[model samples]
Target: MLASPGAEGRADLKLIEEHVQRMRWHVTRSSFADVGQAPAIEQRTGFTEAFLYAAQGFAHGIVAIGRAAITTDNKAYADVLERLHQRGVFLSYLPGTGGPEPT
Candidate 1:
């Protein structure tokens, strides 16, 4: 799981844990960004670690509050999608977490 630092981020992580549990998915690891860090993957150590862990075949997917939790940059998000696709991993979100609401 990935989230920004602070109480809200912690809560988001908890929600992700619950979601994963509900789905019966095992969580091999979790990661979070430092406080005040940009959402870009390159700017977030935790985010990069999560990807690396997945890339290394340690996990089957990445759980996050939402896409914005991963990145808002179009190019960055595309890169992430491609990487996940290449690795046969997935990215999921809690039912009602961050990111723009579904229209």
Candidate 2:
């Protein structure tokens, strides 16, 4: 998950963890990036690392509060979804977080 910065970001991380646990998924790794940074996935170190980790087959899914945690750019978000789909990795959003319902 990509957290913003500061206290709220920390809280978000904690919330994500709780949500993941409730869904019976284990968090083997995590990453954070400031939302203030460029929305491009390549420009965010933490987001990039998370993607790489997933690509390497270390994780089965990436969980976040919403799609915005990945990127605000529609193109970038679609690209991310495609890449994750290619890797057979899933992206999950916390319940009632305004993202698509978990499948």
Q: Model 1, which residues run further than 4 Å from truth?
A: 97-103
Q: What residue pairs clash in candidate 1, if any at all? A: none
- How large is the C-alpha RMSD of every model relative to the true structure? 3.3, 2.0
lDDT of each: 0.75, 0.75
Candidate 1 residue-wise lDDT, 46-73, digit = tens? 8788878887888887888887777788
Off by over 4 Å in 2: none
lDDT of 1 at 19: 82
User: Per the 3 Å backbone cut-off, how many clashing residue pairs does candidate 1 have?
Assistant: 0
In angstroms, what RMSD does candidate 1 have relative to the true structure?
3.3
Encode model 2's per-residue lDDT on 15-91: one tens digit a residue. Answer: 88888888888887666565565546767777777777878988887777777777777788788888888988788
Query: How does model 2 fare in lDDT?
Result: 0.75
TM agreement with the true structure for every prediction: 0.80, 0.83
Please give the lDDT score at residue 73 for candidate 1. 87
